[model samples]
Target: MRILGIDPGLNTTGYGVLEINDRKLRLVEAGIIRSKPSGTLSERIQEIYDGVTEAIDSLKPEVLALEKLYAHYDRPTTAILMGHARGVICLAAAEHGIEVEDYAATQVKKTLTGNGRAPKTQMQLAIQHELNLANLPEPADVADALAIAFCHYCVWRGQRVANQSADP
Candidate 1:
């Protein structure tokens, strides 16, 4: 299966593509969709939509594993802004007929590092080790996106095995 993981943000939306075969993962491509701060809010949102749509068109992922947004009571504005970006990301997936899997940030972190509270640097290092890349994927968002993809792959692969044993 080919999976695309998204870490959506209004200014900088991150994406990572992965191919999973026989429960093993291979990195395809990873990068980000950036919106200009100078643009209006709607413009930023449109940027996210267009960029994500283009990525989905090119990468053609079977599933989009997106990070589910969690709102901190104290940071309602931040949460709302992130929701807008998340909407565009999911819309792109829907337009492409891609299945969507939502995972919590903590879930991805725990799946990658055995600690739900793992720090950003820890996530980056873990992803670097997992992909065996010569350099760590940077700016943190890219690594988070990859970790989300890896978590989705792990769950999907396990479910496949369980379903097989349950059949006949």
Candidate 2:
């Protein structure tokens, strides 16, 4: 199964495409979708929509695992801004006919590092070790995206196997 993971933001959204084949994980692609603060919010969203659409087209992932929208009481605007980016990401996924699942940041972190409050460096290292990458996925967001995908794998692996067995 191919899964696309997304960590959405208005300025810099991160993406990771992972494939589960024969019980192994492979990183097909990982990158960032950047929008400069100088651009209008509308333009940034459009750029995000375009970049994500391209990824969906090129990778053709079976489903998408997206981090759920989160906000701190002190910083409400962050959630509002991210809502725009998430909208476009989901829009692109819908257009491509891919199913979407939303996971909380804590859930993803716990799945990856066994701690809901694991640090960013730990998440990066975990992803690096999981994918056997020579270098850590950069800029934190990229690693976070990969973690989201890995979380889905951990949550669904057994169900997927059972379903496959039932099919035959």
Which whole-number lDDT from 0 to 100 does residue 29 have in model 2? 98
| Candidate 2 lDDT tens digits, 1-168 | 899999888888899999989988899999999888899999999999999999899988999999886776898888788888899898999888899998999999998889999999999999999999999999898998899999988878968778889995
Lowest-scoring 10 consecutive residues by lDDT in candidate 2? 68-77
Task: Indicate which candidate wins on lDDT.
Answer: 2
Candidate No. with top TM-score: 1
**Cα RMSD (Å) per model?**
1.1, 1.8
For model 2, name the residue pairs that clash.
none
Instruction: Quote each prediction's TM-score.
Output: 0.95, 0.94
lDDT of 1 at 88: 77
Q: How much lDDT does candidate 1 score?
A: 0.90
Residue-level lDDT tens digits of model 1 in 65-107:
9887688799999999888888878888888889899998889
Pairs of colliding residues, candidate 1: none
Instruction: List candidate 1 segments past 4 Å from native.
Output: none
